[model samples]
Target: MDGCTGKIEQEMRAGLRAFFTVPYLLDQGMACLEEKLREALLFGRLTVLHYRAFGGTGAGIYRAAAAVEFMILSLDIIDDLQDKDNQETVWGRLSPDIALNIALGMLTLSQHLLLTADFPHERSGSAARLMNEQVLAAINGQTVDLLNNIESEEEYMEMIRLKSAGLLAAACLTGTLLATGEPLSEVRTYAEELGIAAQMKNDIRDVLNWDNKNDFWNRKKTLPTLYLLQSISDEQRWIADYFAERLQLADVVNRKEEIERIMEESGTLLYSSVRMRTHYYNYLDLVGKISLAPEWKEQILAMAD
Candidate 1:
């Protein structure tokens, strides 16, 4: 890890140790924290990057990053539990009740860390409010996603805006609010664009996977899946039948290669790629409009990658 990310991870570990008093909870929290630390701390890095980009100088910014990471970790566990996927994750392997309790505790700890960070009272309040608002928006989005009733590209976009974009926006806005005591509208716009692009990329990958997480297997109405459904030939009607529940997984278990070929031939992948690229470029364009040094802009762009 880079120096900044290493510092953020250190702070995250400290926060877990300081707040989790019960031995069992501490062990579980630490296990989940280590699991998350194995990957890039993208959201936490966004918080720190924005803080630095906005001229924040306090050491408490690391604490703020920790808070962001803790909240994200909690939400990730909740998402996996809700989806009943990612069974290899530490939380997924634990008892559902234990995992749920760990998630709840970490969530509250995130708020505590944020509210208690060494910032001006007004800045802390503003940051907390922004964080809570975005978190609530994410929860609402996740609720809509769980219902699995999205039927249009517009609905899918809206759901992802709330579920995915909201978290990214919150991470950026937290740092901005802590530094400037005002939420930067430009930061929000670019962050949301980035979030949408990232989620679309994930959707494309999920649709291609031949596992429980496969969007087609789950009948998920992602943009790519919707496109596939709309563009399939009569010979590919079995795909539609499976989605509509007229056919079952048994009917298509051995057709993975055929389905992949269909996805490629139907222009579904290209369409999804083009749409994802549009949002990604929009994010870069919006970031360019922000009043920052060229190097800062470059750094932010690198972080997105």
Candidate 2:
């Protein structure tokens, strides 16, 4: 995987270069921002993973892979703006209005690249449509997540499937659609399950943090947070109070270690990890069911692990 990661970054760099020519983009340093996105090319890697798994062997898929990367980065910028997080990012460093414009530009560039690229398959339209569908679903998820209206772990899982897993599903599906002319349902299921599992892992990490990005500080009703709240003790009233808005994060931030210890004592983190692993194994099972070569299937499973 590491061997191919460099090649993907190189291809993505070439594809991302196309967006820098826009006058506004040039003026806004969006080119540098695009370069920054190259550091984390996970979405592009997923595209390549599916492409190769489905027997795609051309360089053209790199174009579409880069497009997926651009689309994901666009959403990430918008998410950061919505959540007011990762202030060190290019979008974060710039004003929200300017960042919004850059995000839109990236998104448009992704679609343009996808539509205009000379893919070997002629049904590129199907790929574009699927991308749009998944992105729209992600938007709905992001809206609900931002609103923080989740009531149960079931609801949280549903929301994350849309927000996190949807993008992964789209990335994999884009590759499959561009290569096979039809999106494979098994691939979609595996990608979605993997996405949810990955998001749960992230949620576990998020709850352990004590910063602006801390889920606890933000009052995010994640699986672990909900579990932690379910059985609170007298000393844990602050945790409840904080979630209830009776206490501000500033008052509780310094005591983060104490609360984290309490969360650990309550088995919140372990519960979250077990839940994540359960979804992960489900994804692995679905991957095994995909009708690919044994080696390719092994590679795909190994990549996820």
Candidate 3:
């Protein structure tokens, strides 16, 4: 991990330790929660990445980054509960009610941490509001995702901007806000681009797999899937039928290779890759424009690369 990500991770561990030591939490299951915190830390590297990229140079951002990590974990728990996938994960292994309780606890903990971060009062206050706004945007996006009501590529992009990019934008913006007391528009643009590009890569992986995490099995309407579905002939309409619940996975599971071929031949994969790279390039351009020293900027860009 980069220095920013590493320091923020350390702070998160310390915060988790402090929170878990509460008498009431200790009376509950401490071992399981400890394991869950370990898992949660893995997802928090982004917060620190943002903190460092946006000029943060002290331990001040640690509390806020920890809050961001907990907020993300809380949402991840909810997403797993809703999707019922990745059963081997900490949240998935536990009973749904227990998972839900943990999610709620993390959500509140995130808020508390954000309000108490060791930043100026004005900056911390604004950061809290921005965080809440972005989270609500993500919730709205998650709602659309769960409903699977996407109708067009444009609509899908919009939903992803809210669901995936919103939180990322908030993370990056929070770092800048804490460091400079002003959130730069270019930083927000770079954050959104990176978030969108990363999500697209995830979508490609999700479509190619053949498990509970498979987006196709889950009937997700990702850009690649929508393109592939529209490009195929009448016989391949069975793919749509499966998505519509007119067929089962067993009937189509054996056709995985064929699906891969179609995705490749139809240019779906290439199209997705092109789209991802476009945003990636844009992110790089913005990084180049940051008013940091050449070496510092190179380090940040290299980290992303």
Candidate 4:
């Protein structure tokens, strides 16, 4: 395994050691994510810093600001060490100083969140101090989404834009800061939008595949269903209507072929595809707008491409 992934695996192990040890999982969702992160680190081939960032933040939620900083450390180390063929490029020259700098910067932001912030959590000071920033970001993202969801086309785009993409954008922004000692807000916005669209495609697979279709069963107000509301033929419409009322996975699965055909023919996939491209271009455009170093810009473009 690569050094970055190795670190992720190690971090995950430590987190799980603490996780399963807890009598009742404090937050199952976060706990489950940590577990998944452990498995992904153990199994996958991710050299990216954000992967490690996701892996490393098992110290509860107060360390998002910290997570951002360490992500930069991981990115800088990866860039310095990995060469053209994705082999080690500059491990020998990569300084401990850089690593230390990354940690200190991350800790600095984490501490900043602690001192002064009206985060979401009313009871848990640490949680409010830590995750409140992310929660606020989420709320802001959701606010924009509520406005956009009025239109069918925009609702899908907006859902994908806010849910997963927001964090991805923040992560990349943090990564860039660690590498270049500078921030790029324009690129940040673009990355955020692209991340959302990519995540939507990910969510779509839940329905597309047989693993889970809870989104439909739950009437999740997701983009796919929203798109389907205005899309598909009467035949497709009736099936979704039935599912909306009945909400049984087997009911849908019994007629999966027919439902899938309707979705495909109704242009839901095509519409989603077009929106995804639009997000990517939006990111690319934002990247171009940034007054960043050419080398750094190249790196940003390369990462996205």
Candidate 5:
């Protein structure tokens, strides 16, 4: 791990140790948290990177990154629980009630850490408010996603902006606010675009895979799947039927090869790739406008890769 990420992890462990005093809570929470820590701490890294890029100094920034990461882990647990996917995870293996309690505890812990971070009083308050607003927006977006009522590309874009992009914006803005005491609008814009691009990449992966989390199997209306549904020929009517629930998984489970071929020949994959690239390029353009040193700017741009 990067040195900054290591610091954030240490901070997160410290926070858990300080707050989760109950024996049962400590055991279960630590297990779930360790699972999350094993993955790339992307949000925490973003917070630390932005803090340095905007001239922040000292160890306080690591606490802020830990707070952001805690909130992210809470949401990840909730998402997996709601989706009933990724049952191999530690949280997934536990009873739902226990996992839910741990998630709620982490959520509160995140706010507590942020509210008490060693920053200026006024700056800490501002950052806390921004974090709450973004989290609420993400919750609303997640509600819409659970309903799965999206009918157009526009709705899908809006949902992702609120659900996925809001979290990234909050991470970047938290560091910027702590460093400069101002929520930089340019930073939020680029972070949101980057988040959308990242979601597109995940959607592409999910649509191609054959598993419990496969987007097509779940009838998820992602950009690629939406395009496939809209542009499929008469011979591919079964794809639309499966999405509409007129056909069951059993009817198409053995047709993965055919579906992959159709996704390629119908230009669905290319279309999705183009859309993801468009957002990424836009994010890069916005990144170029930020006033940072050449080396810092390069480092920020390299994150997209």
Candidate 6:
């Protein structure tokens, strides 16, 4: 997402600064998570940006034809177990173990006050269960996302809701746990809404999703395709079928140009963004309903900075 919702950004930053200021709780949880996952290979672990610890996840996918093809080509199940030199490597390098560890750490840290987590919920839990849920949610979400290509727009949104917002919901629940020790129902609602906003932010980054480098170039089903499917102009629908046939191609540049014209002429990108922002606004309004102190609620609101 290009910018945080100013309100959410303010609110979360304050809550985080306050919550982190407290001794040990956040750190202890994170330590456990790291120790758990570090033994496994972590993908996309570049240093330019630190993981947000929460929000819709974007990196865990084979987004290009080549990337998908690489997996298909590397089908020697024996290769992962027996290293070229050590035969007993016991690691896929991308083992679930590592993601588990990282996710666990995130859940633990999410619990602390972060600035008094009352307004929402999810304040109490056995640390282990919380972490376990985080990893499970991530994996489940990913599974549905992969299945989305074959689903309708409605199903696609559901996948995005799971894969992308599931953890974001966890983030709020964690915050609630640290703040008040309650069931996450209330907090989860807030999270579900915020999840929509977060996804909208992602759509902005995918400005190219409808462009020549469209995410659909890899056959990844996204919001635009669904909307198009729902209200496609004759010209765009004709072009979409053509795009589908080339989903696995090595080159999508030419197709992208054609789609770009269709997207522009049809106003798909703008329409998608408008819809996305509408979700964000709805999420923000949900946050506004929480019962926390004005300042605390405002702090949460400020986070969309």
lDDT, candidates in the order shown? 0.90, 0.81, 0.77, 0.47, 0.91, 0.44
For lDDT, candidate 5 versus 6, the one ahead is 5
For model 1, residues 1-305, the per-residue Cα lDDT tens digits are: 24877888888888888878899989998999999999989998889889888988868988898899989999999999999978999999999999999999888888888899989989988888888887899999999889887788999999999989889989999988888888999999999999999999999999998778999888888999999999999988988899889999988888889889999999999999999999999999999999999988998899777
Off by over 4 Å in 1: none
Query: How many clashing pairs does model 3 include?
Result: 0
What's the C-alpha lDDT at position 16 in model 6?
Answer: 31
Candidate 1, which ten residues in sequence have the lowest lDDT sum?
1-10
lDDT of 5 by residue, 1-305 (tens): 25987898898998889988998889989999899888878898888899899999888888889999999999989999998978999999999999998899888888888888889989988999998998899999999889886888998999999989889889999999999999999999999999999999999999988889999999988898889999999988999999999999999999999999999999999999999999999999999988999888888888788
User: What's the residue-level lDDT of 18 in candidate 4?
Assistant: 42
Cα deviation of 44, candidate 2, in Å: 1.1
Judged by whole-model lDDT over C-alpha atoms, candidate 1 comes out at 0.90
Per-model root-mean-square deviation over C-alphas: 1.3, 2.2, 2.7, 13.5, 1.3, 13.3
Off by over 4 Å in 5: none
Pairs clashing in candidate 1? none
Between candidates 2 and 4, which one is better according to TM-score? 2
Once model 1 is optimally superposed onto the true structure by TM-score, how far is the C-alpha of residue 42 displaced, in angstroms?
A: 1.0
- Weakest ten-residue segment in model 4 by summed lDDT: 42-51
State how far residue 231 of model 1 sits from its true place (Å). 1.1
Given candidate 1, what's the lDDT at residue 159? 95
Clash counts for the predictions, in order: 0, 0, 0, 4, 0, 30
Candidate 4 per-residue C-alpha lDDT over 165-259 given as tens digits, one digit per residue, 9 for 90 to 100: 65466555443343333335664576776676566666576457653334554444566667777776655566556545655555565776776
lDDT of 6 at 259: 62
Q: Give the Å shift of residue 4 in candidate 2.
A: 4.8
